[model samples]
Target: MAVIPVAIAGAPYEVRIKAGILAQAGRHCRPFVRKNRVAVVTDEHVAAKWRATVEASLAGEGIASQWLVLPAGEATKSWAHLAQTVDFLLGQEVERKDNVIALGGGVIGDLTGFAASMVKRGCGFIQMPTTLLAQVDSSVGGKTAINTPMGKNLVGAFHQPSLVLADPLALDTLPLRDTRAGYAEVVKYGLIDDAEFFEWCEANGEKLLAGDAQAREYAIARSVAAKARIVAQDEKETTGVRALLNLGHTFGHALEAETGFSDRLLHGEGVALGMVLAARFSARQGLMHGQDAERVVRHIGAVGLPASLRALGLDCDGRRLADHMLHDKKMDAGTLPFLLMRGIGQTFLAKDVDLGEVAAFLDEELAA
Candidate 1:
């Protein structure tokens, strides 16, 4: 198992990556578990596939657990589900000192973590992310939240997990569409600053999707390490260093909002398309050569991800879509900082972005 440490100030955690690590979850989690019992919050899809292994592992360590399995989907990330999760934890008699295991994809992790942060004022939680997307991105960072009518993750807290067990074998059972969505985040790390890694991704992305264990592990480890370093520096994103992590999120979130956060466009899919838009917009702003944008679009497209907004076929124009970003969480003093690129592996946050120009630019993109 490879352990990547996230050394955020006053709250450090470890993200463990390996194949078949699920069976040894008890042994791996023994140190941080404060009580002999834990409450596991998961979605039905994940519970069906991974609950037995997780429960057996805990039982092997003589640890007892209670589980709350929710419906599977982005809809699960809401006030109703949040209330359900918190109430379930309370009913399980979980204490502030006991750990609550978030044993599913991003939805479960976000809802459970946010609940743990709110329960008894604050409680301990463990992240056992099952999907590639969760394992690579959402599982490590302390950011936790459920979507509100206002926006995606507009209401979340920074509650880091005590331990994260990411068993890569989980991806073996994921649907191809879901795996491809997760790959978008994987590519983001490369586009953010690791050009060579992006090159590696261009070479291995298909293999990773085809169940290449070695390739998958390498990508996950590299992405996790990159995020860990950033989170350590700016845990709360106060320094904009961590903002680099939002490479494609601004436009991506707008796509998500336009889609009503539905399955019509997955988060990673929107991000895949959003990164392409960012790259092209960078070229338009004279921050980089148009070839760089084309390269990004080509690499992401080669992986079967949607690299253009036109692929989504929304009945809206770019200006309407751009209006959605007005609700972005990154907006401060009415100035939203956009993450743009100078070249592959060279991304920077730009606050001088004019939303009107962005709308006009999108009008051109949608028309294209």
Candidate 2:
């Protein structure tokens, strides 16, 4: 097991990455689970597939649990589901001291984490992220959120989990498409700042996607460690240091909004393409080498991820897409910052971005 500690203000937690760790969840979580009983919030898909294993794991250590299984999908992160989950936890007699276990992917983690943050003022929760997306990115960061009518993640909180158990085995059940999408985030950490790691990913990305256990574990550990270091420096993103993690998120969130946050374009797929756009835009702006930008796009495409807006066939123009970015949660005082690359593994926050120029760039990209 590889354990990475995230030291954030007010709360600190550990993200444990290992294969077949779900069975050990009970023993691993006993210390933080104040009550012998835990309320597990999961999605229907995950419950149908892995709930038995998770329940049995908890039961092994005399930890009884009540389950609040919800419908799976991006839509589950809504006000209605939030209320339903909180009500279910209340009915389960979940106290502030009791830990609420999030037993699914990003949807479950965000919804459950937001619910835990609000219920009884605040409560503890453990993350048992099943999907590759959750294991690497969403589970480590305290940025739990639900999409709103306005945009993705417009409503949420920063409630750190007590512990995070990312079992690569759970990913065995993940579809190849989802695995590839999740690989985008793993590659993201490398793109944000670690040139050597980026090179490693370039070489091993195919193997990782092909289910090489050694490669998967190594990638997860590296990604988690990178995020842990950034979160420790800027937990709430007050300082600009942590914003580097959003290397592709600004453009990616806009793509997500354009796709209605649906499966039409998975979040990581959007990020994959978004990172390419960021790289290309940086090159266009003379900040990065053109070949370097092409390399980023090529690698993302090589892994079967979308690397261009033209491929998505969205029925919108640059101005329309740029409008969506105005709703991004990262917007501050009506000013949006773009994470632009100076080169591979060299990204910087560019607050001087002109939305008009961005629209023009998107127009060119869409025309491509």
Per-model TM values vs. the true structure? 0.98, 0.98
Write model 2 residue lDDT over 28-129, tens digit each, in one string: 988978778889999999998898998998999989989988999999999999999999988988888878899999999999999999889988899999
Q: What is the C-alpha lDDT of each candidate?
A: 0.91, 0.91
Question: Any runs in candidate 2 off by more than 4 Å, and if so which?
Answer: none
Model 1 weakest lDDT span, ten residues long: 29-38
Question: What is the alpha-carbon lDDT of model 1 when measured against the actual structure?
Answer: 0.91
Query: How badly does each model clash, as a count of residue pairs?
Result: 0, 0
Clashing pairs in 2: none
Task: Give stretches of model 1 more than 4 Å off.
Answer: none
**Model 1 residue pairs with clashes:** none
TM-score of 1: 0.98
Superposition error at 223 for model 1 (Å):
0.6
